[model samples]
Target: MRSGTAPPVPSAPARRLLLTAAEWAVLVAEWPGALPPGLSVEVPGSRQRNDAVAALVARGVLRAPVGGPVEPVPAVAADLAVLRRPLLTVRLETGGRGGRRHGWFALGADVVVVVLTLPDGGIELSLAPAAGLGAELARVVPEAAAVTGPTARGGAPPTGALPLGLLDAAPAGRGGPPPTAAEAALAGELLRRTAGSLDCLVLGRAGGPVGAGQVSWLATDGGWVGLRPHPGGSPRRVVDVVSVRPADLGTWVAPTVAALLEGRA
Candidate 1:
């Protein structure tokens, strides 16, 4: 990796990348904006560096959705029909090895969501709002979904959305008790900090043994934030936060978390 280097976005498992200032320059030098799906642009670099670039292409194509920030949900199979927005919903007439994966990347102020069904016998639902995410999202988006967006100041290894199901997966009478007033205030602050240009938010488990508490993600105008709910379900514990970027919206969260660890957040 040198002054000019841009990694490819993986396709098999949907992934997004936040290009470095230098990397962005390299990417724009060749191809600017989203390339056609399955298309690859040669990033400028040495053979070794270029090999890394090809590896990225093999893995996938990284770019923002042409449309805008959008969310994904099971089209027909999903019971939450309300969450379904008007996106270029493509239903693959095939299935995979029971593969169910989903991800999102940022483009400008807009975010794009991707859903895949691997092996060949499932529906791959990818939804992105033509007008990008709207204020109405507050009606359906969980307060925790924003934390998982493109928050890492640098970028995380594009991972799956927070498995929100984990929140309900806890044993009966769980969720600790009700949240206290202070706890509620903290949660509110976290939300307030990252609510302006929010695109998507998913509440899932943190990296830990099973039964770990829930962590909600926010893709906001200022940036991204990852926080876990108080055991009592009040103010969320901040896990990470990252400023937004251009190449991919959701690739900045890792650095945000690092900042928190470094006592900078």
Candidate 2:
């Protein structure tokens, strides 16, 4: 690939690259931020590792020619971009002396994922089902009902307005166990199905305290989405307001990120 050339976002399941643990290590070493955590990649010797890199390049999962630097193609970076494509998006905001906190959400047909930004410059990912999530959100913000709906047949994906406390809650209770294996699988499937399309909810970088309430998103058709806020009433200190909207995210994904890299700066 050329210096400024961007790779495409993989949408088809066939575009998913299945690699050995050794290959994954090589790819991660070349592009540090292009893979999710948990896999243990341990390979021996520079010769074998180099061989794996060459094989990945040959397979079109990466782009590296001779002396060129190894570059991750869509097969490596598409997961990050695809995860950001949701069926419906909801912006959750709360403020107090502890400083302002924001929760950015992407709702899919089966999964409700949230990326929360804390005052301490930390972020967290949470996952839940639409039905269970709606029940929880209503506890914090009664007007959260407007955000969630039947997502089948072009209907809007489920959306919600709730405090981070309620959202971070596990099935056991608030601040309990993280998502189980089953939940994680569902979340992964949701991302895979929504990749490279705008029919789902799309989330973008969350604004700061001094910024506007609504977050913006770019659609695949060269237009903007999420400009219109979903109808709802203000609740209270927990969830003052919520905005559920749409946007096409796959059209703008750069093929080197495994996760949303915006707002980190």
Q: Runs in model 1 with CA error above 4 Å?
A: 1-175, 196-216, 228-265
Q: For candidate 2, what is the total of clashing residue pairs? A: 6
Error of 1 at 56 (Å): 21
Question: lDDT for each of the candidates?
Answer: 0.31, 0.39
Q: What is the TM-score of each candidate against the true structure?
A: 0.20, 0.27
Candidate 1 per-residue lDDT, tens place, 1-265, comes to 4776679754333222333323323333434344222222355467644554444344343332469531222331231132233112211111112122222222111233433322332222233432332321222232222333434333232222222222232543434355455544544444444432222222211233211111234444344343322334333321323322332322323333223323311
- Candidate 1: lDDT over CA atoms? 0.31
**Over 4 Å off, model 2:** 1-14, 30-36, 40-44, 73-205, 209-265
Model 2: per-residue lDDT, tens digit, 1-265? 4697689864322122345655656754644443222222354479888888788788887796588787777534533343445544555443322234455454455555544443344344445554343432322221212222222222233223333233222543544345555544433433322211112222334333221223332121111222223335323113312223221222222211112234323
The TM-score obtained by model 2 is: 0.27
